[model samples]
Structures are given as structure tokens and as C-alpha cells.
Target: MNVTITTIYDELRGFLDDHQVSTNETILEQHSKDESYHTPSLPDIVVFPETPEQVSAIVKVADKYNTPIVPFGIGSSLEGHVIPYDKGISIDFSLMNKVLEVREKDFLVKVQPGVTRNQLNKELKKYGLFFTVDPGADATLGGMAATNASGTTSVKYGVMRDQVRNLEVVLPDGEIMHTGNLAQKSSSGYNLNSLIVGSEGTLGCITELTLRVYGIPEHIAAARAAFPTVDDAVEAVVSILQAGIPIARVELVDEHSITQVNRFSETDYKEKPTLFLEFHGNEQGLNHDIEFTKEIVEDHGCKEVHFEEDNAARNKLWEARHNLAYAYMHLNPGKKHMVTDVCVPITELAGAIKFARKRIEELGLLGGILGHVGDGNYHTSLMIDMDDPEEMKRAAQFNEEIVEYALERGGTCTGEHGVGIGKMKYQQREHGKAFSVMEKIKLALDPNEIMNPNKLVHSKRRSL
Candidate 1:
């Protein structure tokens, strides 16, 4: 480390304890990579901040030294969002994990950034409320909000940007700011909340957040329907959405994914193209919804349909779906995970998925296709040996192909995974001239380009 960098690290100890500030090789190595296929780069130091003030103080020190700062959560992010490429200080948030408040009467909850989705849900259960945005990773809320993540239930509840009511962030210059207020309705000055939510930590470090929650549904019914083909299953989902049935959760799992799930989970799910679905409402209304869903599936030549109302069975069904990616990793040992997701119009979802699958097959790679088809977002989870240049080349090509197809159909390159290093190359193509505006905003918030630099938006002074 240089003299200035050494001085900053030594001064950071004033704000936090020795144990909270780590220069250990192991900790720096751990902060170097996320769950994605991106190569790792070690940081010089890792600082655990217990409060927003501590974060701001740390940022001030880093800014003074002209050093980069990457926010670290649980490291569950799949897009290399937490990787510190500049080899500076990593501001770790794991110590700030606390459910600060539960405003059950107003369906709002305030939490520190490091709290995981599962942890918040466990606390919300007492109030008969639940946080709906589950990216299926038990990810820290800060990481989820940073990526604007969504999962199966997003079709009904909305994505991270929608659920977030407010955020407490530490600006790059060591200033604490709140993006919004407690009141939900605001024709306010500027929508800073939305901007900061998905900036992937390029804008600022999220310290705390107040998010909208939902009451536990009166009734939740889960089901699995096997279709004769992948296209048939996807088309059935489209028909269901068109019919306006409020599905709480609707996920599509291709035959390959099913095979992996069955192999890993040791459950005999039919190894066919299938839709795992759920509904939330009163008993009578939920039954009606289920009947309509069945009719739609049957119309698409569904081979068989099964429903699960029991709590254990229903939880197990969703659990298996959440674990689908892990099953792929289990099946392909000694391989890195390169999962990518894109969202297209509901009308084009079936074709988009078909195109993605075809590309995956032509490349002769082991890949599994699945998605939350209700809102037209899907993922292709691929396992690749990083040492194999050919495999890596094909994976990149497949991602580009799918993203291009989705963009042509009025879709986005990334559904929930933010524009970290993984999706950075597509921002210009996806946003066109408007990306320049984003660059301006990034420059304004982080003039030094210290907060997760080289992420969603590059420093204005830096060329592409």
C-alpha cells in the first residue's frame, strides 16, 4: 500500500475497533469475489461498519485518499456486484444486520442493510406480514435493493424498487441522506430512491432502508403442472397472465432443470417442462383462481396437474424451486456458476425462452433454463469450467444472444441482477443516449468514482 492509503487505513481505526477493520489476507480474499463467474481481485482492506455514521466516516477517509470503496453484504450477489477491482477498502455491512423497526400497522419495516431476506421474514411473521421480494438467495436486503432484485412473487408484489419506501445512504463525500419519506405518495422533487436503488453501489452505500411489506395472504395455494413441451408451458403462463388471474408466484422449470432438481433434492418431480404456481386470496376465490389456472394449463395440453395446500408440502415445493441453481452446481462439480437473466414483453417470453434454449443447446453446454414467467423474466444457469476458453466463449455468446433478442422485443438485459461487471457492457446498447444521463448522475454522486467504481455507471472522466 502507498503512504496515503496506509494513513487512511490507520486513521479508520478511530471510527471502528481493530477487529472491525481487517487487513487479513483471508478477509480481503473473501471480499474479492461474489457468486458469479467473474474473476476475483483482492482488496487492500475490509472495514465493518456498524452504523451509517461509521460508514460515512469510512467513506470520508477513503475519499480523502482517493481510494475506491466497494460495499460488501453477505456476498450472495451473482453479478460480481461486490467485487473490488481497484484494490482499496471494502466496506462490509454484515455487522449492521438488525431489524430496526416493524411498523406492522402501516405495512412498513425499517432495517439495517445487512439484514437478510429470511431474517426479516422470520421477524415479520409475528406481525402476520411478509416481505415479498425473495431473490431466492437469502441475500442481504442492501444487496437485493442495490440490484433491484425480484423473484417468483414479484409478479404480484413487485420488485425491490417497488417495495422500497425509503433509503438511508452514505454519499461518496461522507454525507448521510434519505432518499424518501415515510409517506408513500410523493410527487416529490426528484425520484432519488429509484435512482439509488439499482445503481449497484456505484451511487452510494446503502446503510438502512424502509420497505413496504404485505400481509400474509388469507390463503396460499401451490401447484405444479407438467406440460408436453417447454413452449407449451411458457405459452400457458402467458395465457394465465392475459386472463388476469392474480398469481402470487409462477415459475417455469424446463425438463433439464427438473432433472437436476430431482437428482439433488431426491424428489420424483416429473422430468417434463413444468410450471410451479401459487395463488393468494380467500378460500373461495383462491379455489376459483386455481380452477381457472387448471383450465388454462389443460388448454395448453398439460400432461398432469397437482396442487399442494398443506404448509409443509407447499413450502417444500417452493424450496425445491429456490434450490434449482444449487442443484446445477451440485450436478457439475468443480465448475463456476454463470447465471444470467433477462426480461422481455409477456407476449415475447415464450419465443425468447425458446431462443435461449436453442442457443444453449447449439453451444453443447450443460445449462438449465427457468424463469418467473408471470412477469416475463427468465434465467439460464450455466456451469462452466473457467479454465476452458471455449466454454467461457460460448457462455458469453449465449448471454449476448439472449440479451439482444430481449432488447429487440422491448426487454431489458438484466431482470434483477444489476449492471455490475457482468452486465456493464450492455448498458450503452440497452439505454442508448439516455446512458449519458446516467453517467452524469453517477459523476454528480460519486465525483471521485470511489463507490463501487466500474459498475453500472462509469466515472465521467473515464472512457469506455
Candidate 2:
């Protein structure tokens, strides 16, 4: 017995506002998919909840109906975490966007789940404070927390989990709970806050987040260093880290990505394996750091190093880096992008990149390699036509081989993107005996398997 939109609407009508529930095909179709390459399954309905109470009520109703509930942010997830694969309700929190409080004195900000990093930064600019975990997209704070996302800045500031101090969650049984306090750190039993930060909405819906903020640095400088080989760039990053240079951002872009960036951003940068880097500190400190970094990079065979001091030029440089994925999409119009993320130990990063590059070339795929090198994590963005089964197969094979390589080298299959549908097969391989423990936790939190069902875990559907 398949659950229908009419059934859900009838059950939720009394508890929600008239306009909050949507059954329109256009809206449902729009919410059905994310930025990933996974196949989409249209949800029976979409609902926008504005408050924790309302979200709890919605969860209760869905639980009663045994309908899967997926928490949706901006749908910027690269792992298909936001896609409604089993056909349920996509609870969109866009309307709940609100920055409730900014405690400058304590260096923390409390915000509603729908608040995005860009949006929060706009507000924090007045206080000379900023949040640093940027995942390329202006993704919602809730989504970032769901995926434990990190990007270029994560090399210095850490990922979403690092910034999140507390979470107000609505559990599957409609119970509201606070995961942590506003304190800086704690020895408290069981770090539930850490557990829920990357739960991917299978455990609960995040209604509010208490995030740590940072004061804007007095000095900032951006630099681009081109290398003769990708291995040289990776080795340079490792040397920089080992030398204890406080790099604010260290991103690796292979020759393929530089080519796409050149075509898309209309900038004539050398098409070579490069590291787009940045540093933030006092002027004197940054100067010394940059000088030391330059020396280390030169020793590693750096071909050219260009530094940008002006704010506008620096922003433009990063803008090009952020647009690399979009550029690949534009270059391969009418095709889907398949990105595989894997992280290895710093010493092994160069070897891993070399192997992946050889494999990608052997498979004959149009893709580029890029990532936050400071963290020893990288992603290969493959442009594949969904209509071509052969292309999809080759992409999957490439992803599997790279993940296997990483796992064998004591690394994770995914560094930032959560295990949605794309990386589910590797969970067992990566977690080993611990994977069973994860399933037990899932069963305990969501016995009915109604919260984002068939995601992050493999389980059989209970008969109604």
C-alpha cells in the first residue's frame, strides 16, 4: 500500500497552515532532486515548517502515517542526501530562516536551521565577525551540519562539526531535545552534539544551531602557485603543513580544472596543476608565513607563484575556484556531474592523486581534480551524460576504484559529502564491524525507519 499525497495532506492539514503544505507537481518535482547525479523520486508532498513546534508536529504526523520525512535545505548536497528516493515528504526549512542571536562577546551565534553561511556572514559583517565553513554553495546552515560539510576554509577553520556548539533537534518521535550547551568545551558524557552534526537528518531534524564565529583578521593575502606536476603540488602542501605555516586556505586544482576555470571565468591563468592559497594574520606574521611558504614551494619545483594583495583581486581568485564545478557543468551541457571525495594521510596524498589521475585517464573521462589540500582530501568531478549508460558505468567504476584505493591506504571514502545513496556501498567497507553499531543506533532512533528512510543505512522496509 503506497502512501498518497491526499493521505498526507489530510493528516497534516489541521496541524499546519493552509499554505505550508504543497502538493503541486512543480513544487514536488523541484524538491525531488538535489545537485547530485542520483535518480530523483518525486515526493508525495512538500511542507515548509517555520518553527520547532511545527516541525515536531509534522514529524509526529509523518511517523503516524509511516511516511518517510527528508529534511531539505538548499539541495546543494553533492551526495544526493536531499533526494527523495523512496517518495515521501521533503520538509523544506527555507521559511524558517532567522538569525536569532549573535553573541559577539562569546564568539557564538544562534540561528534557525534555514540560515545560510552567506546570509549569516552578511549579518555578522557589522560585528566584524564571520563564519568560515563554506562548502562552495551558499548552503543552509542546517544542511552543512547535516553533511558535516567543509570547503576551502576548512583547512584553517575546521568543518561544520567544529563550529557547531549546540543543536536543537526534533527527534523522530516528536520529542524536542537540545544536544549541547553554549560552553566552549565539555567533558560531558557522550558527545551527542557531534553525533547529530552529521546524522544527515536520519536521526532528527535540526531546528536551531549555535555556531562559533571568528573575528575578521587584520591582514589577508591570496596566492596562486603553479606546479609542473600534481604530485609536486601535493608534496608542497604537506611540506607547508609540516613546517607549521598557518595557511588560512590551501586548495589544489589540477590542470583539467584550471582549463575549465580559464574557459568559464575568462581569466588567462596557466593550465597546470596549481595550488590556490590564502593566509590570514597580522601583517608582519602573514609576511613571514608567506615568505616561508614561498621557499618551501620553490624547493618542491613550483613553476610560478603569483600573490594578490588587493581585496577585489583576491575575491576574484577564489570566485574562480568556487566556479570550477559550475564551469565543468557549463563545459558539458546536458550532462550530469559525478564527484567522488576521498581523504588520505598527508604523506599518501601525492601517491593517491597520481593513481587516480592515471585511472581517470585510462578510463577516458572528462573530469578534473580539486580539493582542500591542507586536509589531504580531494574530489574528482566527472561530467557524464545520464542518458549514456556506458558513461554512468565508467563513472561508477572510477569512483569505486578511487574509494577502494583510499580505504586500503587508511582513509575515508568520503571526506565531506555524507553517505547518501552514492557512497552507501562503501560504508561496510570503511566501517567494518562498526557499521553494525551504526545500524543499531539507527534502529534505536528510528525504529519505523520513517526519517529519511533507505539513507546512510541499508535496512528492509517494515510491512504495514
Candidate 3:
């Protein structure tokens, strides 16, 4: 152990219990990596801080020592956002998980950053409220906010940044600040809440969040529509939106993904490019929307369409879609998963997916194309044999091609995964001159570059 880290470890015990601080190999290894395919590096120490005060003290110590600080959540992030590449102090937030408040009438909830989406939902159910911004994974709200994640319902409810009302962040120098307040609208000076929510811990550590929630839908319906081709399915979605159908969720599952879903879920769904859709409204309005949706899909050559009216059936259908990544992992044993998260304008969605599918076939790689097409975001789920140099190279090439296509057509390199090293290379091209502004902001907020170094933005001071 290095002298500096060893001293910091000893000093941390003064503020936390002996068991709260850990140097054991198992704990270090757990905090080293997330769900990404990126290589993992162990942090020098892992600390469990129960309160924001302890978090501030830990950051103060790290700042004094010029040590890198990486916040660890549940490690469910897909873009390596939680990996401690600099090997310093890993602050695990599991010990601080708690739903601090629920203002049911105001439709706002205050929660510690460590609380998971499902965990919060369970609590919100008591008041007939639910948090939106689900990123498929039961990711910690902090990690979701860090990545600015969004998923199926994003077309209707918006992304993580939209749901976030306020954030209690601990800055790099251990000073705590609140980025926003509970008011519904604000013309306030700077929207720091938006800035910190998707910083990926580069700017600060999110200790608490005040988020907006919604009442449970009065009428919910899930429907699956099979199409002859990917283009047809996507066209249907665009048409639905244009027709003013307020879709709660509309996901596109290509034939490859459908096959995986069938095998993994033990269902007899047709192996065709399909659209999984949902609607929320009063019973009469929802019925009309469903009928209109069927007509629109039929106009675009939909082969068959069916709806799930009950909660159990709807949940099961969505569960299958959410588990699609796991299905690929399960089928491709001994392989690592890397998903491309490029989002484009609604008009460019079909061409982008077509381009990605062609590249996957040209590279002779096994991958599936699927996404929340309702919001013009999709992913190419790739499974790679990391040991094979040729396979790794091809996978890298595919990702680069997909990202390039997205960037060329006015799309983002990363829609929700955050920069997280995987999409770091495309930042300059995607943001152009604005990329410099991001770097300046990072430096201004974290001059020492101790907050999750080597992520989202480049650091001027930190070499590693």
C-alpha cells in the first residue's frame, strides 16, 4: 500500500466505524468494476459513509491528498461509469440508502442517492405515485442521475434529467450544495440540477435527490405488433407519434431480439421485427388510441397485432424486453456484452438502425438490434469473446461505425450511458467547440480532478 492511501485509510476510521472502512481484497474488487466491458482497476480503499457529512469528510481527505475519488453505487451501469480507474478511494453509497421524504400531494419525493428505482417505487406505491425515468436496470437513482438515463417511457415522461427536481451534491473539496429546489418551474440563474445529474461524477457526488413522480395510470395496456421488416416497425412508431397518440412506451425488437426473447422467456412470440407498445389514459380514450394505433400499423404492413390488458400480462411482456440483454448474455456464454447507445432524430431512426444491422452482418458478428424507438434511441447489443483479438477488433469497429453514423446525422454518441470512457473518444466530434466549455466546467468544479477522474470530460491536472 502507498504511504498516502494508508494514511488516508487510517484517518477515515476516525469519522467512520472500523467496519465502515475496508481494504479487504474482496471489497476492493467489488468496487473496482461496473457492468461495462471496460477493464477494471481496483481502488486503493473502499469506504462506506452513512451520512452526507461523512461523505464530505472523505472527500476532504481525498482532496487534501490529491487522491482520486470514485463514487460506487450498485454497479449496474453499462458504460463503466463506476469503475475506479485511478485507484484511490471508492465511496460506496449502500449504507446511505433511504427514502428521506415523500410529499404525495406535491408529487415530489426526496431520496438518498443509493436508493434503487424498484426500491423507491415500492415505497411510492403506498401513495399511489410512481417515479418515471426507468433505465431497465434497477439501477441506483444516483447512478441513473449520473448517467442521465432514460428508457421505454421516455417518449412520454422524459429522461432522468426531466424527473430530477433538485440534487444535494458534495463537491470535490467536500463542500455540500443543493443544485435546485421543489418548485415546478424556475427562471433561476443556472440550472445546476441538469448539470450535475448527468456529470457522471466528474463534477460532484450526488448525495440526495428531489425527484418528480406520477400517479398510477388509470388505464394501462400493452400491445405487441409484428412487422415484415425493421423499417416497417419504426415507421409505425413515427406515424403513431404524428397522429397524436400519446404512447407511454414503444420499443422496437428486431427479429434477432425477438428470437432471443422467445428462447429466454419460453414464449411463442413471432420471430419478426416487432413493436412493443403501451398506452395510459382513461379506459375510453385508451381504447380509441389502441384502435387508431392498429390502423396505423396496418397501413405500414403490420403482420399481426395483440394487446395485453391485464397488469400481469403487461408486466411479463415488458419484463421480457428488459431482460433482452441478459438473454444475449445467457445464450452467448463466455462472452462480454457491449451495447451501442446512439440516439438520432425521429426521421433518421430507420436509416440508422439499417446501417447498424448492415455493419453487424458485414463484420460477421453476433449481435441484436433493439431500442426505445419511441424516442429515436436504439442499441446494438454485441457479445464479444474478449480473448479473441480479431473478434474484439471487429466489435470495436462496429461500435465506431455505429457512433460515426449517429454523429454524422445529428445524433448523440451516447444517449444515456454517459461518456464513461466508452464514448469518450466521440465527445470532441459530437460537441465540437462546446466540448471545450465542458472541460472548463469540469476544471472549475473539480480543480483537483479527484471526482471520478478520466470520465465524461478530460482533466488538466490529473495525468492518470
Q: TM-score: which candidate is best?
A: 3
* Alpha-carbon lDDT, every model: 0.90, 0.91, 0.91
Per-prediction TM-score = 0.98, 0.98, 0.99
User: RMSD to the native, candidate 2?
Assistant: 1.7
Number of clashes in every candidate structure? 0, 0, 0
What is candidate 2's lDDT per residue for 1-464, written digit by digit as tens? 24465777887888888889998889998898898888888888899998999999999988888888999999989888988877778999999999999999999999999998899999999999999998888999999999999988888899999998999999999999999999999998899999998889999999999999999999999999999998899889988988998898999999988999999999999999999999999999999998999999999999799999899999999999999989999988998888889998877888888888888999988889997889989999899989988988888899999999999999999999989878888998999999999999999999988888777888576311
Stretches of candidate 3 above 4 Å error?
461-464
- Tens-place lDDT per residue, model 1, 1-464, is 77876798789987789889988989989999998888899999999988898998999998988898999998988878888877789988999999999999999999999999999999999999999998888899999999998988998989999998999999999999999999978997899999988988888999999999999999989999999897899889888988999998899998889999999988898899889999999999999999999999999999899999999999999989988988988889999888988999888988988888889899988888999888889999999989999989989998999999999989999988878888888889999999999988888878888988888876543443
Runs in model 2 with CA error above 4 Å? 1-5, 462-464
Model 1 weakest 10-residue run by lDDT: 455-464
Query: What is the Cα-based lDDT of residue 114 in candidate 1?
Result: 96
lDDT leaderboard ranking? 3, 2, 1
Whole-structure CA lDDT of model 2: 0.91
